[model samples]
Target: MKERKGLIIGSVIMIAIFVLMFIKGEPSKSIMVWIAAILTLSIYSFLYKDNVFYKFAEHLFVGVSVGYSVSVVWQNAFIRRVFDPLFITRTYIVNDKFSLYLFLGIVIPTLLGLLMLSIFTKKQAWLIRIPIAFVVGSYAGMGIAPSFQANIFEQTRSTLYVTLSISASIMIVGVISTLVYFFFSKEHKGLLGKTANLGIWFIMIAFGASFGYTVMARISLLIGRMQFLLHDWLGVIK
Candidate 1:
């Protein structure tokens, strides 16, 4: 009885929203507006309580997203990168000698990729490690130098290259103090203890700023949804 009453209330609310949308919204955009409104409300249903409507909306979103991603990968990656290079395109047209290099490039990667599928077979499962190792090693080899340059070298250089201005001086001090706070080689006593205490203040300030930024981002999303509900669905605002 409780579930039926809740359903009845939900249906009434949806009907009222639909009527308002149809009355106020543009005729040309009515169908799309209705769809967006319904989906939005369906997702929002979770705020009240977990229900069949919310589950349906959640599943629908996942299904559509996966289907779209697959289509994109098929068109953009598989067909263009793999199929065309390996089979459809003719490298010999440009230079007969270069054909072997092009063929090997495609064959090597394709075999490596296919080796990943060996995991499905019990006997051939060990073969999957070869591809996995190759992928991991290649990624690590390519990423390490750039990651180190960006994170370590660049950050250290920037910290040391501080200007004589008040803001820059404060930043330098804050950074040094923060580093000292994390340094546990010696006991944080006397001057080092005071600096470490100052570092805690800086860390708290950074955390508060980050939390404020996150809240603003969430509020921005809420504003966007409100704009859609008003301007697009009900035409209450331009």
Candidate 2:
């Protein structure tokens, strides 16, 4: 009963809005605006109650997002990296001659990519693991050295070697306490326990700040949507 009433009310409101928009708004742009408005309202309908409108909007959003991502990847990754460099520029070859080394550079990765499609077949499913392992190992090798330098060495150097000040001293204390809290070799008792307790305070403060930042970001997005409806669609704000 409640769901039926809500749906009827929503339909009536949407129809009335569309009629008003069609009468007042420009024909071509108004049609697009109407669609944007409907989709936005459909998404917001979830806040009131779960219904077909919300589901439709969610599925449409996911489908469009996935389609756009695939197009972007194909153009940027494959077309630019593989097609342009090999066929157009032919930068990998010299004197219009075949070079095994140059050709293998592109061929090996291309073959590995094609092998990924073998995952659909039961017998050749194992071929997919070769490319997957290559991708994982390549990323790990590329990422580890820089990550170790930035996260470990640089942070340690900054914490220990930074000029002494109130803020720096606080940071130093926080780092030590946090490390001590994670240290399980010695039991967290007496002085160690107090330091660990201090670490808990620092952790909670960090978490609270992060949560507040996230909340503010969400609120900003909500404000943007509301502004669009009011100022852009309804012309209620300048």
Candidate 3:
């Protein structure tokens, strides 16, 4: 009964707003603008309670995002990298002569890709492992150096760079204490126990800051939608 009453109230408010816009000659002429307004409202309806409108908007957003991603990958990655080089332009032919280096580079990867489709066949299912292993091994090899450089080396360098500063001293202590807290080899006793307690305080402060940042980002998105509705759609604000 409460849900029904809330739904009716929401519907009346939406209709009243649209009617007012119509009266003021401020109704959006663009079909796309109307669609955007409706979808935005549908998503925002979840603030009151979950309903069919919110679900529809959620599903539509996900579906459109996935479809767009696939289309982009197909056009930009596969078509440009694989198809165009192999069959269309035949760029593997260096000068007027065939280049073994270019040929192997393209053909080998293409064969491995085709091997992935072998999973569809019962007898050839094991063949898929070959490409899978290759992909995993190559990606891990490629990712390791960059990830280590960024996450470890760069972070450590930045942390210790301004060692004289108060913030840097706190970060240095935080890093050391946090490392000690995770060192479970010996029982945390005496000084170790004290350090670990300090680590807990640092960890809680970091987590609280991260959570607050995330909340502010979400609130910013909400404010953006409100601005769009008030200024662009309703013409209530310039």
Task: Tell me, by TM-score, which candidate is best.
Answer: 3
lDDT of 2 by residue, 24-136 (tens): 65443476766887899899989778999999999999999999999999999888878887899876778978788987888789889989999999999999999999999
**Which regions of candidate 1 fall more than 4 Å away from where they truly are?**
1-28, 96-98
Instruction: Give the per-residue Cα lDDT of candidate 1 at 69.
Output: 99
> Cα RMSD for candidate 2?
4.1
TM-scores for all candidates: the values are 0.83, 0.84, 0.84
CA lDDT of every candidate: 0.86, 0.86, 0.89
Give residue 224's lDDT in candidate 3 (0 to 100).
Answer: 96
Screening candidate 1 with a backbone cut-off below 3 angstroms (N, C-alpha, C), the clashing residue pairs are: none
Q: Return the clash pairs for model 3, or none.
A: none
Better of 1 and 2 by lDDT: 2
lDDT of 2 at 193: 96
lDDT of 1 by residue, 1-238 (tens): 9998999898799779767776876533678777878888888889768999889989999999999999998889778878887667854335555667767777788789889989999999999999999999999999999999999999999988877899989999899899989989999999999999999999999999999999999999989987888778777667
Model 2: colliding residue pairs: none
**Better model by TM-score, 1 or 3?**
3
Model 2 scores what on Cα lDDT? 0.86
